[model samples]
Target: MTAKPLIGITTYLTRARWGAWDLKAALLPASYPAQVQRAGGLAVMLPPDEPGAAEAVVSRLDGLVLGGGEDLDPALYGQAPHARAGAPVPERDRWETALLSAALERGVPVLGICRGMQVMNVQAGGTLCQHVPDLVGHDGHNPAPGTFTDHAVEPVPGTLTGKLLPDAFGVATHHHQSVDRLGEGLVASAYAEDGTVEALERPGGGFVLGVQWHPEAREDLRLTEALVRAAVEGPF
Candidate 1:
C-alpha cells in the first residue's frame, strides 16, 4: 500500500503564549499542518536546529514546506535592513537557508509561503525590496496587523503556478517585503496588479515553487496537493 507522503514544514522559533505561559517555542500555525493533512500528506514540523543539521533532517522528508514567519536578516541577500524592517531571526534564517539548499540538492518537492518565498530567492542569489511600501507606495499588501489583505494575483500561463492556479485569482496576502531580483534559474511565475512578483518557480521544474501569500490561510489546496503529488509521483 502507498503511504501518504511525509511533508516537513519549517517552524518559527519565538516566544509564544499559550496555557498561561509565555515561552520560546518551535511552532507553526495550525493551518499549515491542517492544510498538508487536508491535502493527503503527513505533516511534520521542522524547527530551527543547528544549521549543519539540515541535510540530515531533509534527507528523511518526502517534501518540504518553508512556512511563513519573521523577516529574514538583510545580510542574507547582501543588503542593509530597511528602517521599517522588523528585527531579524538569524537562527531561522540560517536553518531554513540550509534546509532549502539540502532539499533542492535532494530533489525534495518544496513549497515556500510568504517569507519562505523570500528565503528561497535569497538563497538563490536574489535580492529583496526590504520595504514593500517603498516600492508600491502603500501598505495594501499587508493592510492589517493580524488580518489578511485580499488582492488579485495573475499567474503566468504554462508555469507550474499557472498550471495549478491557471488564471488570475483573489488571494489572502500579508507581507511587507518582496523579491526585488529574480533568483538564478528562477522565473517569476505570477504577479500582482502593481507588478510585484507574487510567485516564483525553479527552472528545472521539480516542484520548487514559492508564492508570496499564505496558502494555508485560504481554502485552496492546490499548492499543497501539488507538493504532495510531486513527492508521490517523483518530479514533473
Candidate 2:
C-alpha cells in the first residue's frame, strides 16, 4: 500500500491556558489538521525552531501548510509597524521564513492560508497594505474583528486557484491586511469584488499557492486535497 503523504503545518507559538497550566505552547486550530486528514495526508504540527533547523525538517516532509494568525510586523517588508499591526512575533516570522525558504529550495508543495499567504509574499520580496479598509474604502472583506465574513472571489482561469475554484465562490475571510506589490515569480490568481488579492500562486509544475482566506474554517476541502494530490504526484 502507498503511504499517505506527510504534511507539515506550522503552529503558533504563543502563551496558552489549558488544563491547569499556562505557558507558551505551540498550538494550531484543530481545523487545520482536520482539513489535512480529511484530504488524506498525515498532519504534523511544527513549532518555531532555530532557523538552521528547517532544512532538515523540510527534507522529510512531502508538503508544508502555513496556517492563519495575527497581523505580521511591517518591518519585515521595509515599513514601520502600523498602529493596527499585531504584536511582533519575531520567532514565528523567522521560523516560518526558514521553513518556507527550505520548502521552496527543495521544491516541496506549499499551501499558505491567511497570514501564511502574507508571509509568502514578504518572503518573496513583496509588500503588504497595512490595512485593507484604508485601501478598499470599506470593511466588506473583513466586517468584524476575530470573525470571518463571507465574500465572493473571482478566480482567474489557467492558474492553480482558478482550476479549483473556477467560478466566484464565497470564502471565509477575517483579515485586516492584504498584499500590496506582487511578489517576484508569484501570480495573483484571484481577487475579491473590491479588487483585493484573494489568492496567489507560483506558476510552475510544483504546487505553491496561497489564499488570503481560511480554507480550514470552511467545509470546502478542495485546496487541502489539491495539496495532498501535489504531494502524491511529487514535484513536476
Candidate 3:
C-alpha cells in the first residue's frame, strides 16, 4: 500500500467541558480530521507550542491546515484592535505564524480556513477589515456566536480555487472580519456578493490556498482533497 500523506492541523488551546472534566485542552472540531481522512490523508492535531518549534513540526508533515479560532493580535499587522474583534490568543498567534512561515519556506501544501486565512494574510503583510459588518452593513458573515451563517461565494475563473469550486457555491461562514489589503504575492480568487474577499491564493504555484468559509462543516471535500493530492504528489 502507498504511504498516506501526513497532514498537520493547527488546533485551539482553550478551556472546555467534557464528561465532568472542565479544564484547558488542545481542541479542534472533529470535522477537520474527518474531512482530512475522507480525502485519503492522515490527520494529526497540532496544538500551539513554543515559538521556533514550528520548524521541527513542519519538517515532518506533507501538508498543513491552519484551522479557525480567535482573532489575531492586531499588533501582528501593525494595527490596534478593533472594538469588535475578539480577544487575541498570543500563544496560538506566535506558534501558527511560525508554522506558516516554516511551511511556506519548505513548500508544504497549506490550507487556511476562517481565522487561518487571516493569519496567512497578516503573516504575508496584509491587513484585515476588522469588523466586516461595518463595511458590508450586515452581520450575515457572522450571524451568531458558535453558529455558521450561510452565504454564496463566487470563485474567480482561472484560479486554483475557481478551478476546484468553479460555480458560485454556498458555504458556512462565521467571521466578523475579512481581508482588506491583500498580502504581497497573494491574489483574491473569490468573493461574496458584498465584495468581501472569500478566498486567496499564492499565484504561480505550491498549493498555498486560503478560504474564509469552513469546508469541514460541509460534506464537500474537494478543497481538502486538493491538499491531499498535492501532498501525495510531493513538492512542485
Q: Score each candidate by Cα lDDT.
A: 0.94, 0.92, 0.94
User: Candidate 1 vs. truth: CA RMSD?
Assistant: 0.8
Superposition TM-score, candidate 2 onto the true structure = 0.97
lDDT string, candidate 2, 186-234, tens digits = 9999999899999998987388999999999999999999999989987
User: Rank by TM-score, descending?
Assistant: 1, 3, 2
Predicted candidate 3 versus true structure: per-residue lDDT over 101-159, tens digit per residue: 99999999999999999999999999999999899999999888999878999999999
Report lDDT (Cα) of residue 200, candidate 2: 92
lDDT of 1 by residue, 80-136 (tens): 888988999999999999999999999999999999999999999999999899999
After superposition, which runs of candidate 2 have C-alpha atoms over 4 Å from their true positions?
none
What TM value does model 1 have?
A: 0.98
Global CA lDDT computed for model 1: 0.94
Model 2 C-alpha lDDT versus the unseen true structure: 0.92
